[model samples]
Target: MRKWLVRRALAVNVRVKILGIALGVAVFLGGATIVFLRGYLVRVWTEDLRVRAVEIARDNASRSTDFLLTNNLYELYALLRGAVDGNPDVRYAFVLGPDGAVLADTFGPAFPADLLSVSTVRVADDAEIALLQSGHSRLHDVAIPIYDGRVGTLRLAVSEDRMRAQIGEVVAHITLMTGLAAGFGIAAAFLLTYALTQPIAGLLHATEAVGREEFAHRVDVQTTDEFGALGESFNTMIERLGVVERQRTELLKRILTVQEEERSRIAHELHDHTGQELTALLYRVSVVAEAPTLEAARGELIELEKAAARALKEVRLLAFEMRPAALRDLGLAAALQHEARAFTQLYGFAVRCHVAGLGEVALDGESETAVYRIVREALMNTAHHAQANNASVLVQARNHTLVAIVEDDGVGYDADAVLAGPPETRFGLLGMTERARLIGASITFESSPGAGTTVYVEIPIGAGAAEGADDADSSPDSG
Candidate 1:
C-alpha cells in the first residue's frame, strides 16, 4: 500500500512539473503581448484627445477675436471669465496685448503675464501656434493671429491638467479592461489544459495502480479519441500483467521452498560425508607432503595443498556472497565501510566512505540488504561500465532523512535511456528502486553525456530501519 502511494506521488510530481513549465511560458508571453498592445493603443488614444483640444482652442480664439474687433470689451471679458469654470483643460481663454500686460485672465494674478505674449509679438506662418515651454500646470497658452483685416492677436489658453485628467480616465478604463482580459485568458488556458490532459492523468493513475500490484484497477475510458484507444489497449495490457504477476508470485514461492530444502540436504551431506573425507585427505596430504624424503612426490603434494586451499577459499567466498560476514556481524555503516575498502583494493577503483552520526544508528534487515546491495551493485557497475579514474561516496543527514550519494567522474551514459531499457537490462536499477520503495525511501539517478553519474538515496530513519537491524546483526560465523 505504501509502495502504491509513492508511485502515485511520483506521477503527480511529474505532471505538476511539466504543467508548471507550461504555466510559466503562458504568463510571460501573455503579459508581454498585453503590454505591447496597450502601449500602442494608449498612443492612439492620447493623439485623438490632443486633436480635439486643439479644435476647441481654435473655436474659442475665433470668438475672442470677433469680440475685440466689434469693440465689445464687456462681452469679451465675460466670455473669458466664464471659460474658467468650463473645464480644467481649457485653462484661460483671455487676451494679451502688444504690451507686457495680461488684458484679461479667468485665473487670478498668480498666472504668468508673458505666458502667450511671444506669439502675439512676433507673427509666424502656422495653423496651431505653440508656446516655448511644456509646463507641469493646467495652463497651455496659445494665440490666434487675426486675419479679419487687422494686426490683432487673440491670445488664449486652456487647462492642460484637465485635458490629461480626461485622457487618464479613458486610460484607466482601458487598464481595467486589459486586466479583465488577462484574467480571462489565464483562466481559459488553465481550463483548456485541464480538459486536454485529463485522459493522460487518468492513464498515469492507472499505470501507478498496476505497478503497485493492484490488479483490479483498469483503464476503461470509452471514446474514439487517441487517448481512449490507448486506454482500451492499456486495459488489455493490465489484464495480461496481472496473470504474469500471479505466476511470478507462485514461482518465487516454489523456488524459495526448493532452495531451503536443498540447503538443508547439502548441510547434512557436508557434515556427514564431505567433511570427514576432506579431513582425512588433509591429514594424509599433510603427513607425507611435509616429509623431506621422496622429492619427486613433494611437488605434487604441494599442488594438492594449494588446490585444497583454493577450494576452501572458493567455498568461503560463495557462502559470504550469499550474505556478508561484516553485515551479519557489525551494523550497516561498518559493513558499508568494509565493502568500500575491499572494492578499492580488489578492483583498483578509489572509493571513499565517510560516516557521521552513526554511533548507535542501525538499519533494519530489509533496509540493510537493500542499501548494501545497492552500493555493491553500484561499485560493480562502475568497475564494469564506468570508465572512471576516480570516484567518491558520501553518506550524511540531509534535511529530515539520511542521504547516500555515490558519484564518479566517468564517461556517464544517459540515465533516462539506461532506466528505460529492458527490465532484464535494468535489473540493477529495478532491484535498488523496488527495495528503496518498499521501505519508504527514494532513489535518484543523475548523469550527463560526458560529465559523470551520481546516484542518491534518501532513507527516512526511524522504526523501519531499526526493525531489520537486529536480524542483520547476526554474526556470519554464528550462522
Candidate 2:
C-alpha cells in the first residue's frame, strides 16, 4: 500500500503535488482551529451564562427580602415579574416559601409544580446554580436564599439559547475567514509551484534537444541559486559535447585518409620493388630452361636462384614492415629495439634504445600493440617534421607503471599551435593520443619552436610483476 501510494504520487505532475500539499495543510489547520475555538467559546460562554444567572438571582433575592418580610405578596409578585422582563436570557423568575411552597412566580396561573421542587438553597451565604432541560432549550437554574432563608428562596432560570446563537455566529465567521485564507494560500502555492517548475521545464526541454543532437540549445539562467548553477553547468556540458563531436568527426576522417595512404604505399612498394624482382626471376627461369649446354644451364640456374632469393626477401621485408613477426615473438622491448635501428637507418639519425625492468612488467597484447604504435607514430612525426639529427627511445618499468619516452635533438614546433592547427597536421598527434587512451595510458608532448620534442607515454601495470622492478630511467646505451 505504501509503495502504491508513492508510485501514484510520483506519477502526477509537480504542480498537482504542490497543490495537494497546500490544500491538505490548509484543511488541517482550518479544521483544527475551528474545533478548538468552538470548544473554547462554548466553555467560556456557558460559564458566563451561569455567572449572569446567579447574579440576577442573588440581586432579585436581595431586593425581594423587604417585600417578603413585610408580607407584601403583590410587591413580591411584581419583583419576580420585573426580573423576568428585564433580561431577555432569563426564562423565568420565581420565589419558593421556606416550607417549599410557591409564593410568587412569573409563570402566572400556570406555575409548574415540578419547578417548585427543582431548586433549593441549601447554603444561604451564596447563590447555588443547577442545569435544567426545558423541552428544546437548556437552562441554568440559579437558586438564592431570601433573608437567610427565613423569607423564601428565589429561583431564576437563564436559557442557553442566546449564548448558543452567539457561538454559532462567531464559528460561522471563523469558518468563512478560514476558507478565504485557504483560497489565498492556494493562489500563493500556485505561484510558488510555477516559479520552481519553470526551471525544471527548461531543463527538460534542453535535455530533449540534446537527445536530438542539437548541442547549440542553451538554458536561460536568471537567478543566482542552484537552478541557475544547474543551467550554467548544462550549457557548459553541451558546449563541451559539441567540441567532442567535432573532434570525433575529424578523427574518423583522419582514419579514412590514413587507411588510403597506407594502401597506396603498400601498392606502390609491391609494384615498384617486388614486381620488378619477380619479373627478373621469371626471365632467369626461362633463360635456364632454354640453355644449350649443361654448363650454360647451370650458370643460368644459379642466376635464377639468386633472383628468386632477392624477390622472396623483398616480399618478406614488405610483410615485416606491415606487421613485424618480432613484435609478436620477442615482446615489446625487442620489437622497439628493431624499430629504433630501422628508424636510425631510414631517417639518417643516430637512434638509441633503452629498457629497464621491462621484462618484469607483464603487458597484454593490446597494450603492447598500442604502446608500440604510439612510439612508432611519434618517431615518424619526428622524422617528417622535426629536423632532428639524433633520437632516443626509452622503455622503463617504475612504481607499478610502464613508461615510454621518445626524444629528439631537433627543431621542434609549438606543441599547442600544432595540436590546435589544421586536422591534417594534428592527425598524427591525435592518433597517438587515441592509441594511448585505448591502453588506459596517458601521453604528453613537450616541445617548443627551438627546443627538442619529447613524447611521454605512461601505462599502468598490474601488481603481479611490479615488485622488484627498477624505478629509475634506463641509461641511453642499455637495451
Candidate 3:
C-alpha cells in the first residue's frame, strides 16, 4: 500500500504535487489552530463567568442586610426584583429567614417549596455556591449570609446561557478567520509552484529541441542557484556536441580527399614507371620473335627478361605501400619495424622500433590495424612537420592493455593550437583520432614549441576491453 501511494504521488506533475503539499499543510495547521483556540477560549470564558456570578451574589447579599434586619418585606421584595430585572445573567434572587422559611423571592407567589432546600449558608460562613439544573439550563446558586445569617440568607442564581452564547460567537469568529488564512495559504502555494515549474518546463522544451537536432537551442538562466548551473552545463554540452558534429563532417571530407590523392599517386606510378617497363619488354619480345638468327634472338630475350624483372619490382613496391604483406604474415610487431626502416631510408631520419610483451596480449584484427595506422600517421607528421632528426616507436603490453608511444627529438609545435587550426593542417591528427575511436582505443598528443612531440595510444586487450575502452574514450584527454 505504501509503495502504491508513493508511485501514485510520483505519477502526478510537479504543479499538482506542489499544490497538494500546500493544501495538506494548510488544512492540518488551520484545523489544529482552531481546535486549540476553541478549547482555550472555553476555559477562560467559563472562569470569567464563575467569577462574575460570585460577585453579583455578594453584592446582593450586602445590600439586602438592612432590608432583612428591619423586617421591611416590601423593600426587600422590591430589591430582589430589581436585581433580577437589572442584570440579564441573574436568573432569580430571594431572601430566606433564619429558620429556612422564604421571606421574599422574585418568583412571587409561585415560589416553589424546593427553592429553600436548593442552597444554604451557616451564620458564621461567608458564602456557599452550588450548581442547580433547572430544565435544560444550568445555574450557579450562590448563597451568602446577610448580617452573619442572624437575620436571613440571600440566594442568587446566575444562568450559564448568556456565557454559552458569547462563547459560540467567539468560536464562529475564529472559524471564519481560519478559513480566510487557508485561502491565502492556497494562493501563496500556487505562486510558489509557478515559480518552480517554469524553469523545469524550459528545460523540457530545450531537451526536445536537442532531440530534433537543434544545436542552437539555449536555456534562459534566471537565478543564481542549482537550476541556473544546470542550464549552464546543458548549454556547454550542446556547444561541445556542435563542435564534434562539425569536426565529423570535415573529417569525412578529408578522408575522401586523402583517398583520391593516394589513388592518383598510384595511377601515375603505374602509368609512368610500370607501363614503360612493360612496353619495353613487349617490344623486345617481338624483336626476339622476328630474329633472323638464334644468337640475335637469345640476346633480345635477355633484354626482355631484364625489363620484365624491373616491372615486377615496381608493381611489388606499389602493392607494399598500399597494404604491407609483413602485417599479415609476421604480425603487428614485425610490420611496424618494417615501416620504421622504410621511413628512415626515405626521410633521412633514424627511426627506432621497440616491442615488448606483445605475445601475451590478444588484439583483434581491427584493433591491430588502427594502432598501426595511428603510429604511421604520427611518424609521418613528425618527419614532415616536426623537423625531427631521430624518432622512436615503442609498443608494449601491460595489465590487459596495449600501449604504444611515438616520440621524436624535433622542434615540436603546439598540439592544441594545431588541432584547433584549419582542417587541412590537422587532417593527419584527426585521422589518427578517428581510427582510434573506431577501434575503441584512446589517443593523446603531448607537444609544445621547441619540445619533442610524443604520441600516446592505449587499447584494451582482454575480456573487459570493450568496457575499459568506453571509459577511456569518454575521458577528457582521449582526443
Candidate closest to the true structure, highest lDDT: 2
lDDT of 2 by residue, 450-475 (tens): 79999999999886645654433323
Task: Report each candidate's C-alpha RMSD, comma-separated, in the order given.
Answer: 20.1, 3.6, 7.5
lDDT of 1 by residue, 107-209 (tens): 6667765564354332334234454444666333556655442535555555455445655675677667766766676577667666557778888899899
Order of the predicted models by lDDT, top scorer first: 2, 3, 1
Q: Which regions of candidate 2 are displaced past 4 Å?
A: 70-74, 98-103, 106-126, 133-137, 172-188, 279-283, 468-479
The lDDT for every candidate, in the order shown, is 0.66, 0.86, 0.83
Per-candidate TM-score against the hidden true structure: 0.42, 0.86, 0.71
lDDT of 3 by residue, 238-335 (tens): 88887777788899998888799999999999999999998898899889989999999999988998999999999989988777777776677777
* Better candidate number, 1 or 3, judged by TM-score: 3
Worst 10 residues of 2 by lDDT: 470-479
Candidate 2 vs candidate 3, TM-score winner? 2
| C-alpha RMSD of candidate 1 | 20.1
Candidate closest to the true structure, highest TM-score: 2
